[model samples]
Structure formats: C-alpha cells, structure tokens
Target: MTGGIQAQIERVRAELTSRPEGLQRHVGRVLTEALDLARAWDVDPDRVELATWGHDLFRAASPAELVTMARAAGVAVEAPDLAEPVLLHGPVAAAVLEARFAVSDDEVLAAVRDHTLGLSEMPMLAKVILLADKVEARKRQRAPVMKQIRRLARRDLDLALLCWADWKWVEERTHGWQSHAQHWHARAEWVRQHHGEVALPPRVPETADN
Candidate 1:
C-alpha cells in the first residue's frame, strides 16, 4: 500500500475504534477478507481496503438520520430508499467517506455504494469488496446456502457473486421485500450475460449396465 493509502487506513481505523465492539469486529472481518481477495484477484489492495473500511460507516444510522445524510450528501432520496433506509446505508456511507475524508476515487466510492446491493456491471474491485463483505469470517450465522456461496468464493469470484445474487433473490421473495429486487435481478442478468450459466456440481453420469 502507498503512503497515502496507509494514512487513510489509519484514519479509518481510529474512527472505527470509537464505534461499538460489534461494529469493529465486523469491519475487521471485512478488511481481512478484502485484503485476502485483493491479493488473490490482483486488484488494488489499497482501494478495496479503504472501501471495506468505509462501507458500513453509517450502517447503524436511523431512517431519519439516513434521510438527513442523503440530503446533506446530495444523494436523491427516492421513496423506496427513504422507506427502507437500510438499503441506503451503502450510498450514505460512501457519501460520508467522500465528504469527511475527501475520498475522490470514484471506484472506491462506487464500491462503498454498491457493496450492499451490487450493480449490473460492477467493477472488479467492487466485486471483491461485495463478496468479502458477505463471506467475511465473522459472519458465522449464515444459512446453508450462504455457506455454499462463501465456499464458492474461495475458488471462483464470479461464481460466488452469481450464487450470492441468486440467494438474495430467493430471500427477497420469501420475505416479500421488493426494495432491492431490481438490483438483484440486474446483477443476476449481468452475471449470466458475462459468465454464462452457473450451477451446483453435476451428478456423475450413471454407467450403462454391462
């Protein structure tokens, strides 16, 4: 990491240290995942690390606080985003990082914005951060399907994203949450277009009786 990036990391670390212990542990896990994936994927470690640190900076904000922050940051507060501010935390976090720390790199800011709800054609750095955030070690209470996605992340990043999007779609449908349906659909479509089909391991073909 460059001196500049190291300085940013220190600043973020200090800020996180003041937060609740649970939040700090979550950020630590995300950072670890980001660094490991960055090295494996040949992405810019500095960018991924910085984005991970700031991705959840405002995750605990109340709905009212989310609206205020979005307005302050000039991010349009649509009806859906306002109604379900949990989905807006990513964008709100990005805005806060940019405004407070002068983070100007669009990619880093984009990663922070898109980490929770991925974009149609996400950058590789953003993909890394997104997957890292989902599969971080501290997140141990995931369902079986989520465990599979986390395992897939160790082998193929694209496949991991596809699995995650697929799982998220099922979750939304089960919970009747439509706020992020478009995002999940767009990400799934993008993965299909770019990486072709993805699936679970196929069963071995039965040998013909001899």
Candidate 2:
C-alpha cells in the first residue's frame, strides 16, 4: 500500500474504533476481505483498502441524518430511500469520506457509493469491494452461502457476483424485504452475456447452519 493509503486506513480505523462494536467489526471484516481479494483480482490494493474502510462510515446513522447527509452531498434521494434511509448510507458515506478525509479519487468514491446496492456497470474495484463486504469472514459465519461465494470469487468474479445477487434475491424474497429490482436485472444480464448459460450452484438451504 502507498504511504497515503496507509495513512487513510489508520485514520479510518481510529475513527471507527470509537463507534459501536457492530460497526467496528463490519468495517474491519470488509477491509480484510478487500485486501485479500485485491491481490487475486489484480486491483489496486490501496483503493480497495480505502473504500472498504470508508464504506460503512455512516452505517449507524439515523434515517433523518442519512437524508440530511445525502442532501448535503447532492445525492438524489428517492421516496423509497427516504422511507428506508439505511439504503442511503453508501452514498452518504462516500460523500462524507471525500469531504471529511480528503479522499478525492472518483473510482474509490464510486466503489463506496455502489458497495451496498450495486450499479448496472460497476467498476472492477467496486465489484471487489461489494463482494468482499458480502463474503467477509464475519458475515460468512452467519450466512453459510457466503463461504461458497468466497470460494467462487477466487475462480470467477462474474459468476461469484451472479451467485451473490441470486442469494440476496432469495434472501429478500424469504424475508419479505424490499429488493432492488434493477440490480438483479443487471446482474442477470451481465451473467448471460459473459457466462453463456453456465449453471449456477444450487441455493443453500436457509435453515442450514454453517
């Protein structure tokens, strides 16, 4: 890592350590996962490291706070997002990182913005951070399917992404949570274009323990 990126990581770690344990653990896990995948994926380790550290900076903020931050950042807020403000954390965190920490790289900021709810044509670094966030060691403990995704990521990033999206879709359907329709459509399209009818692994049983 560059000296500058190392400094940024330290700054983020110092700030996050003072937050609640859940937030601290989440950020730590994402950072570790991102760094590990960076080498395999041939991405900039520094950028991935920075994005992971900053991605969840405002994850614990209240809905009203998220709205205020998003508006201040000039990010477009939708009605659904206003109703469920947690979804806005990615953009809000991206804005906050740039404003507060002097992280000006567009790719890094975009990765942070798209980490939670992925974009249709996300950058490779963005995909790495997003997938790392899902299959991080801590998260895999609770969601056994994440282990499979982690293994798949080592071989084929695109297929791993499709599986992650599929797993998320099934999870939302089972729990009756609102899902991001466009994100799924994009993942499906990307898989079809790249993989050409390759079969995805069977879904892990929801009731199974890791």
Candidate 3:
C-alpha cells in the first residue's frame, strides 16, 4: 500500500480507538467479520466496519440524556417517546460521524441509521450490525431467562423477535420502567406478517402483547 493510503487508514483507526463510547470487546471482533462479509459481498469494508461501530455510540447514555443532547443539537424530539430511545444514537451518531470523521459513505450511514428498526429487506451489513448488537455482552445475561428467545434465535428470526417482544414485556412489567415495548411489539408483528411463521409469545398476556 502507498503511504497516503496507509496514512488515511491510520487516521481512521485512531478515530475508532479514541471514541469515548467505548466499544464492547466482542462488538470489535464482530466488526472484523462484518468487514470480511463486506469484502466478500463487494461492499466498502471500512465504511461497513465504521457503521457497525458507530451504531452504539450513545448506548450508555440514558434516554433523558439523549433527549437533552438532541435538544441541544436542535433535533427537536419532543417528550422522549418510544421512538426516541430506540433511535437514540442513530441520527445523531451519523451526523457526528459525518462532522468529526468525515464519513461520507452513504450505505454505511444508511445501515447505522436503520440499525434499530430492522427496516424492509435488510441487506447483509444491516443484518450484521443488528445481530452484533443482539448477541452483544449487555444482552448476554437476558438470554437464559428467555427460553423462547433461545428457541427463536436458533430457529427463526421472526419468532426470535416475538420472543424479544415477550421478553421486553416481562422485563418492563417487572421493573416498571419505560421501554420501547409497544414499538418492539409492532416491529415484531410487522416481521411476523411479512416474514411468516412467528407465533405469539406462549406466556405473554394479550395486554402486554399489544
């Protein structure tokens, strides 16, 4: 490689390393695979890995904190709705990446933006980012308590989202905290409709299911 390309690569790596959000160890590893997939599939490898890392920038921040930050940054999200928390990092993260790191890759930022929603006909990079977030360390403990999640994750993603729906239901009910339970329920239903074969949660009550 030429010195100019090597210099550019080092600059990008430095940006990745200096990120204060502190990427999880396995997230870093999965990005290696994400980059490999991006290469195999003819996508830009750097942008793919960058998008994967950029997806979780503000995850450690509370929803209120994100709303406050958003307000400060002029995004104008009102009252901290379920959508706000679900997409806390997405828009702002992309904007930050663009401003600070000059990440102009359309597809990379696109994947980062839609990482939470699992939008229609997800491409490989988007799926990779979502799965990376799913199997991440913060979610590891939530796994065993969720038998249906285990089954669904292993069997079918549509059902997996259903299990995730019920899991969030029980979790929110127990903790009595605000969650994106409704939005996730809707997303699960959407996936089930188009993707097919996902059953409603076995033990989830109808009230929570909705």
List the RMSD of every prediction in angstroms: 6.7, 8.3, 9.3
Model 2: residues >4 Å from true position, as ranges?
1-3, 195-210
| Predictions in order: lDDT | 0.80, 0.84, 0.58
Better of 2 and 3 by lDDT: 2
lDDT of 1 by residue, 15-111 (tens): 7777778887898888888888888889988888889888888887788888888998898788888678888889988888778877888899999
Model 1 C-alpha RMSD to native: 6.7
What would the TM-scores of all predictions be?
A: 0.85, 0.85, 0.59
How much is 106 displaced in model 2, in angstroms?
A: 1.5
lDDT of 3 by residue, 11-78 (tens): 55565565554565545755755565455556667556677777766656678777776666555464
Cα lDDT for residue 97, model 2? 79
Error of 1 at 69 (Å): 0.5
Cα deviation in Å at residue 209, candidate 2?
Answer: 51
Error of 3 at 193 (Å): 2.0
- lDDT of the structure predicted as candidate 2: 0.84
